[model samples]
Target chain A: MRFQKLKRFSCFVFYSIFKTKMVKKLASKNNKIELGLLENSSFKALLNSKYQFSKKIVIVDENTQELCWPFLLTTFEELKEAEVIVLPTGEENKVMEVCFQVWGAFTNYQVQRNDLIINLGGGVVTDMGGFIASVFKRGVDFINIPTTLLAMVDASVGGKTGINLDVHKNQLGVFSNPELTICDASFLATLPEKEMISGKAEIIKHALINSRSFFDELTQYLEGVPNDEILAKAIQIKADIVDQDFREQGERKKLNFGHTIGHSIEGLLLHNKIEVTHGECVAWGMLVEAYISHEVATLPKNELQEIEQLIRGQYETLAINDTIFDSLIQLMKHDKKNNSDKINFTLLQKIGLAKINYQLEEDVILRALNHVFGQ
Target chain B: MRFQKLKRFSCFVFYSIFKTKMVKKLASKNNKIELGLLENSSFKALLNSKYQFSKKIVIVDENTQELCWPFLLTTFEELKEAEVIVLPTGEENKVMEVCFQVWGAFTNYQVQRNDLIINLGGGVVTDMGGFIASVFKRGVDFINIPTTLLAMVDASVGGKTGINLDVHKNQLGVFSNPELTICDASFLATLPEKEMISGKAEIIKHALINSRSFFDELTQYLEGVPNDEILAKAIQIKADIVDQDFREQGERKKLNFGHTIGHSIEGLLLHNKIEVTHGECVAWGMLVEAYISHEVATLPKNELQEIEQLIRGQYETLAINDTIFDSLIQLMKHDKKNNSDKINFTLLQKIGLAKINYQLEEDVILRALNHVFGQ
Candidate 1:
């Protein structure tokens, strides 16, 4: 009887492995957009067969150059002729001056429209590189090889590309899609614990907006990199939303659930010269917005408590003073997502459902903030 | 019998006037892109009926603000709340700095995505304004109310919006269409003789590229502004070509017959601080490219001579020395149209036939330049 139980366990493990391989293969082949797992042999084959660029330029941030580019160079022989353009690391570098420098590099190289720009870094590299390619000689084709988990699940999947204007986040940009996106989970292994926590916020966001089961699964794996199945599910959720609304005209706004307040916080911190990861701000934002959701969006009190508990357990709670509250509200007023001076938000109706364009009163917003700060 | 003859003549004149008005009305109503004559009631109706903006902003250059804005304000009551954004007059200001300033103005004004941007000047205003609106907050709706004949027939018609990178013309840009374009012939009355000649070159180009009969008709009306019928026909011809190939990937390239060499010359002259109008460089380009066509693409010798005579009669032939020749050739090499470092020329097979992506040898190009210079 013990031998039979051991055999059943072995079979289950074999089936799981086979299923993952099949899913990866299918992802590289069929999707609304061409999303490929880079480690998949089929993705490598597609790159070798389809793309015959005259020149290939790989744009990498300092961190990515040290951590990601060596693996990329060794895996793809086509990149032997690829020129490496190293940009400085951090969100601070995601500005117009950096774009100007990158554009100048493209001009110097005489990069043609048919040439390939491989954006190999986190969100900053992908966003900036995508914008540069979209404007250079009207438009050029580019591929996103996102090395960070935040990029793989969030930035690289969405066609949105931009750079900050002074202190404003994503103040200047265009809607331009990359030719292909390769999201390899192996890069997550080398990520620092802080970076991992930052990436986890987006994964948690995907779950909170789409599926309760996915949320439970993700929270269980919060201590380390979630398995390929969980990552793919998170990515697919984002891709489905982005595919429905590339311009964020309607359904796409739901993806900005935590982002409204998150961007304000992120922008404020950046402007104040306080270093903070996007995910950390977003994690805090989700917590605050969840409270707002409970009041205005029919989000249940129990679910809100669970969300707050999960987020608070993972991330350090922000110290929100009256001064910071005033500034945050002021920043929210200037958000690009808001129309006609009315602050619009995407709030969770429940654990798995989100409602967009919710206009909340100032008092309610303040009340929500007070609740978040335990005032 | 004499009374009857006079009655018939009056009837014929009345019918012609009615038909022109009817055509103008139809153009504003039913077209792939709305092409409206600015003074017509239909254009005013469109502004009143379709576009309801909370705020209206007019973008004009120093020259246009002085000459055009007052007339626009007086004509349309909808523009009572309109703010004027005056840029410096000249192609020199069509750079990133100007774009930055325009973006800053839009941000300061808190320009919403639905707000109207009226580009009320020449190609420079339309190009820069369109690009700024397109990139600002992903995109905002804008209208082109072209004051110059050059802008009406060419720049404002196509969705190609861009600004120059230093001396290079249209080095950075995006493909974005304006919501509406209003072309008023009355503005031509106030245009300087030099500016009028500049606008005439694009009209001449349309005739040369598409219709021999139109070419003959345009040459007859060379001294001043052509009748509304002739202007509309020129505008229609360009609109048809642009609609056929919006991206310039294939058939649309034929429209760039003179622009390849024209841009090189324009860029070189601009770099050297020689103030040459775009039309003047294009006029010279049509001459040299026509010679190249005769040698390479079997363009009839008689047709080439006719082109040369018409252009030469209208404008002074550019004196191309060996010094300028080298620079022009160097500029041509760096043209965005070229592939694999080969200089591509769009050569005319005949007066009404243009072939694109025709690779030319260096010696052939040199010979063509020498022939133009009468070396």
Candidate 2:
């Protein structure tokens, strides 16, 4: 494993010097994916396997124009030719309109049916690019080169790709798996601090649901420390769950611990231009939902308190007003996990275990939320 | 099946005495799709068993406000509690933008993650609505109520739902199968002539590829035939193939016999705002590609001539100029089926069997184009 890290470290240095953002993200992010150094070697072998490497590798992104194109050209030099499509970046740009742009690129570039599309960027780039690859001619192959940590631990794995329709986030998408992904921790150094924290939400969720030791490690390094080791641990935790339940039908649902209310808060905050980070909002969601879990859903109170304390330690807590509460509830109803009027939350049954759809009453939820808001 | 059609007929009353374009086409056109009888009953049953249904049914569409809403309310009174979402209609509206509209509706209406979304429209509505349902929260459930022949015979079964991104059609989408699909032929009586013809092309393709007897039956009443038995036969053929190869890895690609070139033509026509139907373009593609197959790939000359004759009888032959040819080729490059510069054509190795990527050179394809254009 240590030798594997050394090899990846060398690969990272080689990938970084001349590779543009697109290829850099691909080589960098993928290199950093903490799915155990040994596991990553297996994934690398899979990429080289006859089944996977039969198609041309095409990296799709706009910002990484200079970055990805030249790098892919050199990397897959023996594969006849490779393609790099540039799409406009940003969430607002992540729509079918962008998909059309990508399709045009596909057509213009002559992307084949079996060719793999390597999406290189943050979530927006990967989401829309993956989407374009997914449906272009009824889906071609795709890989994710998620540049941000949020993407590394979250978007990079799940294979959920989509662009927004109207103001709602990820409103139009698909749940398709990728052929390969390369998440390099080195790319995290390039991201804005806020985006780093945004990625932390998913990391926190992973720690909260599966591994108490991981949680302890994460808490100690909440601000900053030992990026490589922590990243590897986080990646291992997520990969294990994903491997167990790919479709998120059971154990995978537990990954949504903070996401139920977190998504609603993020939706509201994004809609209001409230400038709150995704990780921060999810932290708050974990706090409140954990409290609810303790009271009505059999989650341990100590764990709930610890979760809240940890969240408070990392993020500035916000007050949830009546209007916000109403909207949050309204948004929660749209969550794909809800059954009828019952808004389902993934609760911690213990510090290192989770359960889904812990249906607490509206009043009980409000009380738990109030406690978190310090109201 | 006959009894099923009879039972559905009682409830299939055309909503408006004033026939819209869609209704008029359904009443007049000879698109043989078995609307009332569900063939993939087992698939639906399997899905239902997997998830506990709070809402037994869902109706998703744009024109539902005018057509399906009143009809469903009166007919399936048992579904009075069933939720209905009215989306914006049309190809332009089949986008991530509309998906957001759906998510907003789901949110506003308190649609849960576990609830089902029943798509009730043509290709645009089914594709977009299905895409929304597939990604709502993470994924919920979806059903298809294809009103147009294009959707009923093809889009309804394939689990290929997506919206246009820019010039690319169905570029942003997913391949999540619906729990159920209700392809009521009664909905066709309300479709317009143009829309009916658009769907007819696919019906013709199915007949050409799978069942010659069905083809013989179709030619007898191409212009005007409202017989439910014949329509059901056509739909059954599609359902049979769909059931055999749901993921489109093998036998399902046969369905794209004309689509490689056909889709490029549609993209070019749609982009240039040319007056060409999707089916019509595919019909032309079938003719040209068949010629290429005969000349380059050693197909029986008689089969080639039969294809040409069948297409010529239905469509007013159109000539392709150098510019159009180049543009079409350009679009074909991005057909999501290419490998390198080689364009893949799903051509008939025989009348009943189609081969994919039978690498036809540019000159050979052009010569075939000349034959179709009589150049």
Candidate 3:
């Protein structure tokens, strides 16, 4: 027992030293870069030390404000005095009108440049709130306390914040990073099962591109893991990718795995006011697009089958006619991709490997759609 | 005649060498950190160079969309294909609804990440348009083509963009600078005289704080030089100050000059839906606040007279009552300068100097109000 205790103590010390060196290296790499993600097994200490904000932080949504404040009140202890802005919830509220309300709150609260805004909801809250702070007084610091799984894995990490313009999604925005993100998975417990599934899609994308082992681990543990562990690992996957590509200048585009078609589908569904979660539509999108990759780009039939099988296993497949598929393709063309006119896809060469310019043929997309809808 | 030519050549050569050295030194200083300013300059060049975007850009406003689009089309030489997203004029249209419409145009036109949003109109268009760009797909670059005097002087510079909430001014926002701000004084020729007064107020504020010579020059030339050179210099004053404190950390607060009460009064006037322009209300706010500064801080009687004489000489002053004054003071407390309970003022020590922590007793404010009211 004495020998074991001594060995554990030495291991702990060594681990601490290793972590310090790693964090210092990371800090150096991301100097003057606000939008950054930190990933590691034991990053709790480093996170706690880094985010030292004063008392005037504002939480920008009603549901998230209620759910997140008490814990943040305890964690940042100093943040107990922070004002809660609490605008209405959902994508409908992610409008320029809501941004006005947020700006008013900062003025009403006399938010200073050094002050912080804590965005404590899903993508809408994180994106809009971060955008508000970014332009509020030029730009004030903000932290993302993301609740939903999608935000934890995708929205919260990147510095993409903005409201929708016209019928488009994220048609207006700047790439501005928050000062820190305190993502405690406890927030995920309050999320709906559908939301969890939506988040898992992004996690699955990450695993496919970066770690086959992680994919296996996810497949194994996804059945019935504790919420805390699931959330932690999911966030860890996103953080790892973000750390590698702080901006979407390179590998970060891979993280948009399902998003290309996902966003187009989202815009279409939103315009129609159809009842569909962002993730659900994106899941279907990934499945169909993956089929496109298989048929057009000559991706191995085995890889294509696996992709379809996994997506079908995870989500409820939706049937679409040619009209819908054509409209979807048109939407993709309108995407930030197709600079002049070339359909770009961030596709997997194999599990754990991805490339951005792997163009798929039009016939392949049609075939994939047929496969998905049983035409 | 020969001597004159020789002298001119020598002067030109000396100026060229000096200009080279100055550019090198300025480049070095600005290389570390600095600011850029321009008057009615072509943003097309800067934004195109920065992001390698297409030269064809579109400017949008209800009125200008009709008037300016022709010129923009001719300039970019893409009238055949360039897309324009026009929205209604006025502060009411500066909402999320309009932002959506703008993004819709962007998506429909297949606008890329490197695409530009040229804000054409007053502060409303610049603020909302910039806010839209700041948040779209994370963010896209933007340029301010301020068609109103108010936008050219204050709104276009300092990278401040936001939309207003109900009964609040600039409630939602992010502080993101445009790649270039094209502030053409020729645009001012189209502006109503009321808007010109607003621009003059900001120029006066700039002169009051930093440059006595510029202040003197403006006092002499306020009604004379409504041209590019003066407009460029006014923009330069703001740009230089913003470069010193882009985030409004310390010295930048002095730029508030009269904006503390000025903004509140503007909000009040806007709430009441009065005919007063923004600058007119700020002029009154400055008068009241200056009187308060004189009474409380012993702001040298002669200098106080000069302030009163300067504003009174240039602009019309309304007979504000005690009740109105009392309410205005209450609004001032809600200003960002107030820390919890204490109201802070960026009071003028003399014509060219500002002191931020000029705490005044309540009774003194009352006395100043009475003096301004001519009670």
Looking at model 1, the pairs that clash are none
List the candidate numbers ranked by lDDT, top first. 1, 2, 3
Isolated chain A: TM-score per model? 0.90, 0.80, 0.81
Expressed as tens digits, the lDDT of each residue in B1-375 for candidate 2 is 343344345434542222321321122111222245333223244334654455644545546556555555555444567667666665556666666655766766666556667677887777887777776755777777787778877787666767776556676566777766666666666567877777877888888778778777887878843355555566677767766776667777778788877887778777776666777888888888788778776669987887778788877654456557877776776655556676767777767666665766677777776777654
Q: After superposition, how far is residue B332 of candidate 2 from its true place, in Å?
A: 2.9
Q: Write the per-residue lDDT of candidate 2 for residues A1-375, one digit (tens) a residue.
A: 343345445546644453422422122221233232222333345456643545554554554554334443434443344455566755556766667656766666555566667677887777877777777766787767677777778777766777765545676666666766776555454456777777887788888899888988888888842365566567667777777776667887888888878878877877775666667778788888888788877777777778877778777766456557878877776666666677788888887888876775688877876776644
Angstrom error of the Cα, residue B345, model 2: value is 1.1
- Looking at model 1, how many pairs of residues clash? 0
Instruction: Tell me the TM-score of each prediction against the true structure.
Output: 0.92, 0.79, 0.78
Fnat of candidates, each listed: 0.51, 0.67, 0.57
User: What are the runs in model 1 whose C-alpha is more than 4 Å off?
Assistant: A1-50, B1-53
DockQ for the candidate 2 complex? 0.42
Residues A227-320, model 1: lDDT tens digits: 7777778888888887778788889888888888899889888888887889989998898899999988899999999999899999986655
Predicted candidate 3 versus true structure: per-residue lDDT over B144-246, tens digit per residue: 7777777777787887787765545665567777766665443444456767887788878877777767767877777832444456567677777778876
Ranking of predictions according to DockQ: 1, 2, 3
Which run of 10 residues does model 1 chain B get worst, by summed lDDT? B25-34
